[model samples]
Target: MGKLGDMANKAKEMAKGHPEQADKGVEGAERMVDERTGDKYDAQTDKAADAARRSYGSNSTTDR
Candidate 1:
């Protein structure tokens, strides 16, 4: 697999073992993005949050 695929697999394994940590990481990433973009990309942030939650096998905190 390529580098991106390898990274994706590693993240999946991490989420499977520690969902809460993954969720926190996702939240942190979202915050960083928001700060960098001045909250102009709310949709993208929400989408990322949902993807994070899904990766960890948890329901998305952000309502679609």
Candidate 2:
């Protein structure tokens, strides 16, 4: 795996123990992107962010 892949795996492991924080991080990132893009991709970004949040053991209200 490449360095990015390695970092991803490490993050997943850390998320296992800090799911809430991970979810917050994902949401924060999504919000930042949406703001930067003027909400153009808000729907898609929310979907992906929800998935990422769930992967870390957190359940997001936006996940449906």
Candidate 3:
């Protein structure tokens, strides 16, 4: 749980100043999950990305 919190914080920071980096982070995280779970959690990646964006308060449609 602590690690998850830390990741959330990092994602928020990335989304705040560098959305592209946040996107990359999401992709990387997804890839890691796929590698670990044998692609069993493909749908969860989008949820993770959305959560990260929301954590940063940058989930808006407009570019920030």
Candidate 4:
């Protein structure tokens, strides 16, 4: 597999057991993007974060 595919597989494995950390990772990445872009893409970022949350968030969380 390609590097990206391998990385994705690793991330999937990591998230399988530690969903909260996966959620935090998504939030951190969103924050970094927002910071770099000076929040100009807040709308898009928010939407993406929501999708990520649904995918990675714990079942107990509202977003999930």
Sort all candidates by lDDT, best to worst. Answer: 2, 1, 4, 3
The residue ranges of model 2 lying beyond 4 angstroms of the native Cα positions read none
Q: What is candidate 4's lDDT per residue for 18-42, written digit by digit as tens?
A: 9878877778888899899999997
lDDT for 63 (candidate 2): 46
The superposed Cα distance between candidate 1 and the true structure at residue 51, in angstroms, equals 1.6
Cα error, residue 28 of model 3, in Å, equals 0.7
| TM-score of each model, paired residue for residue | 0.81, 0.82, 0.55, 0.69
The digit string of per-residue lDDT tens for model 3 on 17-60 reads 88766666766776788789987876676576567666666654
For model 4, the stretches where C-alpha displacement exceeds 4 angstroms are 57-64
Query: Highest TM-score among the candidates is held by which one?
Result: 2
The C-alpha stretches of model 3 lying farther than 4 A from their native spots are: 1-11, 57-64
lDDT of 1 by residue, 1-64 (tens): 9999999999898887887777778888998998999999989898878876886697548443
Positional deviation of 30 in candidate 2, in angstroms?
0.7
Whichever of 1 and 2 has more TM-score, that candidate is 2
Q: What is the C-alpha lDDT of each candidate?
A: 0.82, 0.83, 0.68, 0.76
What TM-score quantifies how close candidate 2 is to the native fold? 0.82
Better structure of 3 and 4 per TM-score:
4
Each candidate: RMSD: 2.3, 2.1, 5.5, 3.3
Q: Which is superior by TM-score, 2 or 4?
A: 2
lDDT winner: 2
